[model samples]
Every structure is written in structure tokens, then in C-alpha cells.
Target chain A: MNSSFRVTALLLCMGPLVSVLAEPVPDLTATLKAAFTDKRQATLDRLDQDETQKLCTQLRDQVPTSELSQKITRMNLATVKPPADGKYLGDWKAGEVVASTGTGLQSSDDPAKPNGGNCYACHELAPTEMAYGTLGPSLKHYGKLRGQDPAVLAYAWSMVYNSNSYAPCSNMPRFGHRGILTEQQMKDVMAYLFDAASPVNQ
Target chain B: MSVQDRYISLVAACTLLGASLSLPAEQTSEEAIAEYHAMFGDENPAELWQLRGEELWKTPRGSRQVSLEACDLGKGPGVIAGAYAELPRWFEDTGKVQDLESRLVTCMTNLQGLPESEVLAVKFGDGEQKSELEAITAYVAAASRGSRITIPLDHAAEKAAYALGESVFFYRAGPHDFACATCHSESGKRIRLQTLPQLTTSEGAQAAYTRWPAYRVSQGELRTMEWRLQDCLRQQRLPQLTYGSDVAIGLTMYLARNANGGEMAAPSIKR
Candidate 1:
């Protein structure tokens, strides 16, 4: 047999082997897009992950390296926008409402209604509320423990704006940064944490 | 009494008081929740759905006027014993990896000649409206009671499905930046009063996966695994997960595979 004929036979033998060896990786992006549909308040675009989220997802249960963690924190911290009017506190009563209420941006939620902080879902905000979660530490006496200094107030504001700023990959939602809570609502939540008369302080 | 005798009696009384104080210390919240669930005992409402499902399975219906007795659940036709424990497998006829719900859709459409739309119309049950799929899932899952979970991942498709599921579990997106891992990757964590299972570990996966297709007391409905995934996504503030979608099957495959060697105990009662 000629050299060309032998080469053709070799190529034919290797083709099926290569195909068998190369397992097809499912197109997850396409699969995810196809798997869900747009609903009220929640659209298909919500599935799109930002850089920080993508990195966190890649890490999964594993802790990120300190450098990577700091990078994420810095990226998220940049998104935190302090109150424009320089007022860090709002009505404590309204803040209490925001902290307790859990409905907001959910598919079933009405878009017209204001969003809630849902702080009690992962925190012990007040001593009276019996059904607080243990995922986060008890912030029972937040303001009482940390005095009302400008630096402390700024830290609290930034923390709520983007929890990843302090603890990267925190379970807490980025209320201000993600548009889950408005500037007024976040101010109210801050009051709930800092106001001397608020239940959180008591 | 003598001074020595009085001193000894005082010490004994103090010891008794300490023991009594320690004996009835308050129960942890987890213990309390478990006790509350146990109070229901054999009064699981899922039994009603299971009965309805069994009837649906045996009775002849649809355009073909055939019962689901001839339907194959990865254990040949008409065999339901321990079938669910080995599900989310590769199906030759459909050429896809399917969970219990998706596989039923196929059988209902192909064997019974029911329209796919009609079969999938009601994925979940509401107060007045009932879902036939949820009922059927209860019946099928019950059949596998005490059977060990054994997702072999032997087929290439099954492996692919498992991989997709792993990615889905870890993929964080949406407004809250939450994935299944956010709440479920840690041990002894709670979201409000509810105790979350750490599904990353085998113990957590087995404990959680085996008790699905439960009668949710809060909703007054029997919920299937598919319903669980759908609701979870909704709570995550993400788009609505389509019924019987690939992501749903993939997630189920991942959870079920992690629960390998665990005994099935489905159609259980839940809060």
C-alpha cells in the first residue's frame, strides 16, 4: 500500500477513539438560561453573575485566598455609596419595620411595595423577637457596645451597603449595593441598629 | 443535732439542689422542633396523596386508555419496588437523564397519550386546585421506603447530569447573591426558626434527601422534590424555575447521588 493510503487508514482508526475519549461538557450557561423564565419583579437577567459572585461561586464551600478575598471585598466596597445628605439615621420605627419584614423583590412580591431589610432572618436584632436566626452573630446591643462615633457609624453604613466589604462571601444580602433597599430604607435600618431608643439597642 | 451532723446535712442538701437544677435545663431549639414534628407521629397527611396516586397509577385513563402498569421506571415495566432509590438515571427511549417527575411526564405522554401540556398544567397544588404530579410522586417515593439510594453514575449522560447539578448547587447569582450553598453548606445553621441542612456532607444530604415529597403543614400540601427546587429558586429572588427542566433534574441527580446508601423515607411530614 502507498504511504498516503496507510495514513488514511491510521486517521480513520484514531477518529472514533478521539470522539469516544472526549466527553462532552454540557453547556451550563445555555442550560441555566433555558431552565428558568422571567417572573414578576424577578427577570431572566438576575441569573447573570457579576465578577465577585462568579469568583465566590467558583470557590463554593472552600475559603478564598486572603488576596482573592480582599480583592472581592475591595470590588464590593467600591459599590457602597454613603447617604448623599450626610444623614446616616432615619426613623427608628420605620427602621424596625424594615428589619422585621421579609418580603421584597421576591417573584410573588408587589413591586410597588417597599423592600425590607429582613435582618432578623440571619440575626438576633432584638431580645424580644424569639424567632431570630443563628447564621450571623447576635447584634442585640450593636450601638450600645460600639459608641456613636463617626468612624463607627460609617463602618455600620458600609457593612449594610455591602457585607462583602468586611467579610467576603458573607451570607447577608447587599441591601444598598444590589438595590434591594433604597437609601431611605438603609438609613432606617441603620437607625434601628444605632438609635438609643430602638429595640436593637435595648 | 451535733454541729458535725448539721454541717454534713447542709452539704448534702446543696448537692441535691444542684442536681435538680441541672436535670430540667431548657431543651435546645432544634430539639424542640424535632419534638414538635414527632408529635404528629403516624398522622402524616401525605398518605392521602399517596392513596390518590396509587389509584391514578392503576386506573386506565388518557386517549390510549391504558394504566401506568406498563411504564418502566428504570427497573423494567411494572416494577416499582426500590425504583425511586435508583432514579435520575439515563433513559434510552427519551435519550435524556430524568428524575421521577420528568420520567413520569414521558410515560404519561407516550404510553397514556396524554398531551404534555395537560400533564404539566399543575406542577404544584394550591388550596382548591390539586396537582396529580405531586400525588403520583408521593406514591412512587413511598414504594422505595427502606431501599438504599444508589445513583451509579455509570452512564455518560448520568455523569454529565451530576456535573451540571454540582455546578448549579454552587452557582451564585440573583439579587441576593445566594446559591444552595449559601444556606446549606454549613452545619447547624438556621434561617429564622428553620434549621438548614448542610447538604455538602453525606450525613446532611442523606438526612435531608430521604425525607422529601413531604406533606408541608404550613402550606397544607404534599410537596415533591421538584416543588422544593422551584420554591428555593423563588426565595433566592431568581427567575421561576421551569417544571421538569434540565437544571431541576441536574440538582436532583446531585442531591440523590450524595444520598447514596441512605434508606428512602419519603412522603414524610414537614413544617
Candidate 2:
């Protein structure tokens, strides 16, 4: 065969192989939409990614760039709404229940009932709780060590309101920001952390 | 004093003091759990499900009154040994990448003429709801116990599925803002007392993936990978994941491919 003809024939044969090898990436948005269906409280809209989620998802297994992280933190921090009455603390006894309770937003959870902080699932609060998880830093003596300074209380409130405000892509849930906990419930939890009489402080 | 005598005295002293005898200070919770598994020692209750699965596979039912003996599970028809390891592969017949459960649904619908609804009606058994699919999965996985996971991403569809699966693993949404990576991407982390496996790495993926289709003692049922994923999404507070969906297959492909060289050990027992 002529040299030109040989090259042309080779190219034609490799065409199918190349096409087969370079598979088109599936549309993840469409896939997720079709894969998940509304169940009770969790709607199809839950699959919709916000700006922070989209950025975080793209940066899978990689920490966000410092600039991007700060931007995300600022954006999330902007969403935080402090208590209307300016009271940061409530009943610590009630807060203990909020921290221990691990039910809310889940499809199996009852919508009528109140949501829980489920803090022990990731942090060690009261020293007596032996089964506490270690995902987050120990919160034992949180109030004892860090006194009730206005700035300190504000930081703690923001952390509960939206964890991403400080650490973008945090595993901790955005309890107040996401409506996972009510303002009153959040105040109660704040008390649980800061009250000197609270078991967490003890 | 002998170890037994010392232990007895310790227990007695604790009982007299109205204090509970706790695990040895040196024995971590994970080690204590490992010791609990050791007590079962070849006494897994999964065997009961396996036996039931074999019977279901061999029995002739469905509209066609044919058995799944002719079903092609990546390997040729009726060749089940080590076939599971190469699953979520390209199937020209369906023109999609399918995991074992999805493949079984295909075979049941095509070969046995069983309705897809009936096959997927009772996905996981609870109380009175028994799953023949779980039984069959146990049987098939048991057959490939020692085989290495070797999901061939050779086909274009398979490659696409793997890519999609990886994305799904890291995709975060919902009220909780959690993804599979949230709980599973970190090592030595726990949600309460349950250990979270870091699935982004090979060792973590293998450790987590190869042990599914386990007999969950807590649930009193044999759970499959599909069930595990569904339950996880539920906990993440995401919408209910559709059975045999592309995303489901894709996630399976990602985990199975990541667990490429690990030995299969499904139909195992778990807390």
C-alpha cells in the first residue's frame, strides 16, 4: 500500500478505539436528580448544591485554597443571625437534652417534634459521657477555660450558627443556619457550653 | 494469683462497691469490638441466608418458569465463581454498568420474566418483610469469598460510571451538609461509638467494601451494599435513593474499583 493510504487506514481504525476510550463524563446533576426522590421531610431540593457545597464538592479530598476558604468563611459568617433579644444563654439543663438528642431532619424523624444538637456524636462535652465521639475537639470545661467574654460568647454562637463561618467544609452541621435547631434551642445549647454549673464545665 | 482469680476478685470487688466492671483500660473500644467478633468464630448466622439463597437460585419460578441458572453475572451464564469480583462491568445487553443486585434484577426480569416491581418490592427485610434478594446476594457473595475485587474499567460505560460514582461520594447537600466523604474520608473517626472508615484511601475502601452484605446482628437481617448506601443517605438527611439507579451503580463501581486487589469477604457478620 502507498504510505499516505496506510496512514489514513490506520487513523480510521484508531478512531473507534479513541472514541471508546474517551467516554463522556456523565452529568452528575442529572444523575443525582434522577437517583434521589423526596422522602418525608427531605425533598428533591435537598440535592441542589449551594455555592459553598458546589465549591467544596469540587475540592474533594483537597483543602480549599486560603483565599477560597476565607471567602467561604465570610459568606457563611454573613448568614449567622444572633439571638434577637441579645440573650446568648438559656437553661443549661434543657441544653443538655438538646446536645444529647440525635434526631432531626432525617426522613425517619418526626417533623412535629423538636430537633437535637447531637453534639456528643462528634464532641466530648460532659466528662461523665464515656461513649462520646472524638471527631471534634473536647468541649469539656469549654466555659470554665474560656470565661464568658462577649467576644468569646459571640465566637461560640457563630460556631453553632454556622460552623463553616470559621472552618469551610467542616463536617459539623450548620444547626442554626440550616434551621436544624431553633433560636431558643441554640441559646439553651449555648448555656450548656458556658454555664459553670453545667456538667460540661464541671 | 492466676489471671482468672484476679479477674474474679476484681469483679467481686466492683459488684460489692456497686460499680460496673468495665473493659480493661488498655483495651480500646475498637479492640473490644474485635474481641466480640472473635467469640462468634465461624458461627456466622449468614449461612442461613446463604442456604436460602441457593434454594432461590436453583428454584424455577417467575412467569417464564425458568431459574436464574442462565443469568450472566459478568462471567458467562451460570458461571458464578469469582464473577462478583468483576461486576459493575459493561453489559452490552443492558448497555449499562451494573452491580450484583442490579444485575440480579435484570436477570430476574429478563430470564425469569419476573416483574421488576416484585423483585425490588422488599429491598431490605424488617420484621415481616423478607428479602429474597438479600438471601441471593449472600449466596453469590459467599461463592466469591476469597476472590479479589477486579472491577475492569475497560468499557466506556464502566469508566463513566466510576467517574460519576467518585463525584457522588464527595457531593455534599441537604440540611446536614454531609457527603459520603464527610464521615468516611477521615481515618480513626467515629459517629458515636461506630468507627468511620476513610474510604478515599485503598486500605480504608477495601476494609469497608469487602465486608458488606454482612449479617447485621443489631438489625437481625443480612444487609447488602445497596442497603448500606441507602441507609447512609437517609442518615445524611438526603432524599431517598432510588434502587438500581445509575448513581447507586456508580457509587458501587467507585468503591469496588478502589477495592480492586482486596479479597472478597461478604456474607460476613457485623454489629
Candidate 3:
């Protein structure tokens, strides 16, 4: 008797709302949610979006609002942090190793291991580092061209710290923002660029 | 065990077949370049990268909190547009013909006061600094948008880079005993749905070289030029390549020159 009473109550509640929701597309959130099986470091929360991410998705990389873009840049710029010691540019030799290796990250990666830079995968840094990608510019002899300009130094640092801070929808990852690189690592990469004795200059 | 053996046999067969085949007698390097140029009618995805890259160019970064507005790019400090077209050109101050990624490293270290090694330590798609390299490259390439793909071969460095690139391209190693020629030597070879362009031919070189920093729909991440090379290296299973290594640059010089005049359309989106 109770079961039948409950059924009737449920039917009554749904009957009116059915018509109201008839024009709307059926929600598939439940189906998608049910299919999700998060494993090891990979969680479902990656699907969640903040305001800027949502806007980018809506615009599909064609965000028309210059005001919105500038707003995003300014907003992200405020989030960046400077090194504690105020030192930049570390050892370039270590950086070359870092740039070459593509280890760490992913669920299989050991959290204890340091991450790699994988520079050859995109930008051409050292002319000798063949098998480099052409997606970005060739970085061979980068130091020779720039020659320790103060302004150049700041821009490169900011780009690594938080790429989005520079460009709202930049493809580059936000290293400092995401905590991917330590302050020391950023400095080492800097040395790879500016050091006169580095292979980049050679 | 037999399955593994079969894979070995298949590889062996492929090697034999590749060796046996050559470019069609009538197909000239010029024809190959023309074939690549034909694809330019479609939109150049590099345009998008340029926009994002330009924004990143002068944006402030790091703990010091500054922008790259004054960052020098080859001709002078803070100039970005068309800088890419001439680069891998000679630089007198440091006395080298550095590529873009290396140049960004210099600016980041000196201007922003970041350790060069840490940034160098990062790999493509691995960390934030590497990502900046991508954005900057896109921005820089965009400055040379619609410009010709002329990797100046006049410099001794350029010539040396070309020789190194050629040597690297054919250098064979790894568990599978593969070389770049394995997949890239022919006009019609493919791994699956993707057609492998013959790197030996100018058309293939241009089509492949001029379309990087590509956005991959399947992976949903922007692939940098370095990442592309690294992926090839990874699949090859040799020792991991170092960033800014001479071998990589030589290969780049070789390929870029082969694709010269094809035009750049980077920061391209790919399916």
C-alpha cells in the first residue's frame, strides 16, 4: 500500500513538470557522470571550469572582447610571484638536460622525480639539438641575438612563470602558476640563454 | 614471441621496400616544393598563434614582476615583428646564430633575473617556461606571417647547422632500429590515417616544417616545434635529446632550408 502511495505521489509531482521541461534538451549529465572512472592521479575534477576557461570554450578561441582579454591578462598578471631571493638565471648545463628529457607527469610518473623541460619538442634552442620541432622558432644561438637585454629578461621570466598572464589564451603552460618548476629551475634555464660560455652562444 | 618476431619481420620488409623505392623519376625537388605550396590556399593556423604570442611578448612575468616590452629580438631590443624571418641568422654580441628558443632563454635570464638552467631544464609540454617558449615562438612567427621560409644558408653556422641536420635525420638507433627516413622517406607512406611526408623531398619538408606549434585535436594541447621533434625521438627510442643540442639545430637547419620559400603557417591547428 505504501509503495503504491509513493508511486502515485511521484507521478503527480512529475506530471506538471514534464510539460515545463518538454522544450529543453534532455540532460545527459547523469550518463556522462556515470561513465566516468577516475584513475590514479587522473580525476574527473579536471572537467570543472573557471570563468575565463568557460568564456574561452564559449568563444572557441575567438574571444571578441578586447576588454575581456585585457581584463584576463591583468587579472592573471597579478597572480604571479617573484623569486624569494630575487635571483634569476641558474646553470645552463643542468637546464640542457632538463630541456632534453620528457619524463615525469602523467599517472605513471613518480611524484618524487623532477620534471623535464622538453624544449626540443617545440622551440629550437640549440642548433646542435637536432630532432627539434618547428612549431616555435629555432632557438639556436638565442643569446647571440638578444645579448642580455634587461627588458628581454623580464618578458621571458614572466612567460615561464605564468603564460596566461602574458596572453589570455596562450597555448604555453603556466609553469610558475602551476608549480611545475621551482625558482631554481627557472634560473638555470635563464643561464642557458645568457651565459656567454653556454652552447647556445657557441 | 612470434608476434614480436613478426613485427621485426614487418620492419625488415619495410626497410627493404623503402630502400628499393625512390622518388618518381619526374618528381623534382621544385615540384615537391610546389606541391607543398599548393596547400597554402587553406587558412594558415599560425595566425592564431601570432595573436596569442604577441600578447605574451611584452607581458610581465616571474617573481620580479616585469614585462618583455624591451626584450631584444636580433635587430634590436624589443622588436618582434619579422625577427623570425632573419633569425638563426648571425648574432654578434654573443657571436652565434641562435634560434628563437635560445634567445628567449637569454632574455628571461638577463631581463627577468631567472636562472637560465631551470628554464632550460624544462621540456616541451612539461612545464611553464617551455610553454612560454611556445607562445613566444608563435608570436614571433606571426610577425613573419606570410613571409617566405628562407633559413639563410649563407652563414657558416647555417651551413654547419644544415650538415648537422642532415646527419641527424639519417642517424639510426633505438630498440626498433629506426631512423627519420623510416617513415619520412617516401611520398605515400603513413603510420595510420596520417600520411608521412618524405622529408627528403622539398614538398614534404615544407609541408611538414611550415606547419608546427600545431594544436592537436586528439590530444587537445598545443604541440611546439620541439615537441614534434621530441615525439619523433621518443618513438625512435634513442637517448633523449638535449635542449639546444647541435644535432637538433642541424636537423632544423637542414629541414628549414629544404622547405625554404614554402611560407610559414605555424601555431596551426591539426586534426
- Top candidate (TM-score): 2
Per-residue lDDT tens digits for candidate 1, residues B101-166, read 999999999999999999998889885788989988899999999999998888988887877888
lDDT of 2 by residue, B33-140 (tens): 465456444556677678779999999989999998999998899988998777779888988888999999999999999998899899887747889899898999
Each prediction's Cα lDDT score?
0.83, 0.83, 0.58
- Candidate order by DockQ, decreasing, is 2, 1, 3
How good is model 3 by TM-score?
0.46
Model 1 per-residue lDDT tens digits across residues A1-202: 6545654664453221111122333555567989999998799989988888889887766666678888999998999898999999999899999988888999999989998888887899878887788889899989999988999999999999999988888888888889999999999989999999988888
Q: Going through the candidates in order, what fraction of the true interface contacts does each contain?
A: 0.68, 0.71, 0.00
Stretches of model 1 off by over 4 angstroms after superposition: A1-27, B1-40
- Candidate 3 overall lDDT versus native: 0.58
Give candidate 2 misplaced runs (Cα > 4 Å): A1-27, B1-39
Name the candidate, 1 or 2, with the larger DockQ value: 2
Indicate the docking level reached by candidate 1: acceptable
